[model samples]
Target: MALFTNIARIQDGLLLCSDSDEEADYTKYQNYAKQLFQKLEAMEQKIDKFSIEESEFTYHYYIANGVCYLGFFKKNYPYRAVFAYLKELEEEFRRIYNQQEIEEANRSFTFIKFESVIRNLRQKYTDDSSLADKNIQQLSENLTDVQRIITKNIKEVLERGEKLETLNLASSKLSNESKVYAIKARNFKWRMWWKTYSPLIIIAAIVFLVLFIKFFIW
Candidate 1:
């Protein structure tokens, strides 16, 4: 929750600062930054949805695809990699939160995680300093692709974040409308039932009167 809040604050702050500033680069950077935070916010929402909070101290987050449980991480997992991936997932989530987004990120976060894994691989390569140029080239190419995506999608993602905000509002309105309609329908049904059964009740009374007259008057 705090994580989500922090991301939201950062997102809002970047937007506010961007609005106040006059510099183009700074504005663009702020836009990207806001987009980044929006992505994080979206990721938090997804985690909350598919996740089951295991009491106040822990939570089990299910991955979107395969519905695989990520296991219960204690309230605060210290692995930077985990947080980073979550953060990246949020980024991806912001870009696409629809079914398409969810499906894509189900696979996309793998690449995001792969970014870290490849970084570790590169480090290992440097440590021994004996890895071939071919492997290096492959890793470099993959990394380039990842960066290109992040760069291009920051704006695309910010747009998605905006859509999420709109969606939330629309969802709230639709829910309220449904509730009101339900109440009206229930009231209408109650009235109709009364109207239909009231005649039967009157007929029963008239039949009872006729039976009493036949027995007593004759």
Candidate 2:
């Protein structure tokens, strides 16, 4: 039989169990119980969605390029998986945002991803009615808005770039045409000048020839 088999009593909210032996083995059992409790708490947290009041959300912005847009982040948010996804987007569009011009865009994408994942997780938690599910509904909605804005802006920028290219090509063609027309006009002027001088020289030569012939006959 254990040395302290029945001596252990309930202290606070923990089971104070002791071993019925010369050296008590409470340490082992206590450690095991603590581990189990931790696991249970973690499980519970997963099932319940944490509420985030809208009033706490002061960082939300809409971004658009032309056709569609996405959200931007203001502060770093906790959520590893979601933040990783957002980091990818930021890296992809870093050049478009003029990295140095607005540091906010980078931050915004991160927050949006974090919020989106949390919202999905919350929905899942709600379905099961778990206390661990921390549903960030407000953040999720904001992320959606940001995505819309970013998509629109990106599309617009692409369209605008295409248009600029088209206009550049057309202008180049016009410039070439003008040069060709100028060359043709110069050639026509040269021909007209030669024609105008040749007649006068011919008339002078004819008059000189008649005078020379009359002088010889006399």
On TM-score, the candidate that comes out on top is 1
Question: Model 2 has how many clashing residue pairs?
Answer: 50
Off by over 4 Å in 1: 1-163, 171-177, 209-218
The sequence of per-residue lDDT tens digits that candidate 2 reaches over residues 1-218 is 11111111111112221122344444443332233222222223122111111221211111112101112122233222122222233343443344333323322123232333433433332332222123233233333212111122222333444221111111223223324333433454566667889899899999989998989865
TM-score of every candidate relative to the true structure: 0.23, 0.19
lDDT of 2: 0.28
| Lowest summed lDDT window (length 10), candidate 2 | 1-10
Off by over 4 Å in 2: 1-164, 171-176, 208-218
User: What's model 1's overall lDDT?
Assistant: 0.33
By lDDT, the best candidate is 1
* Model 1 vs. true fold: TM: 0.23
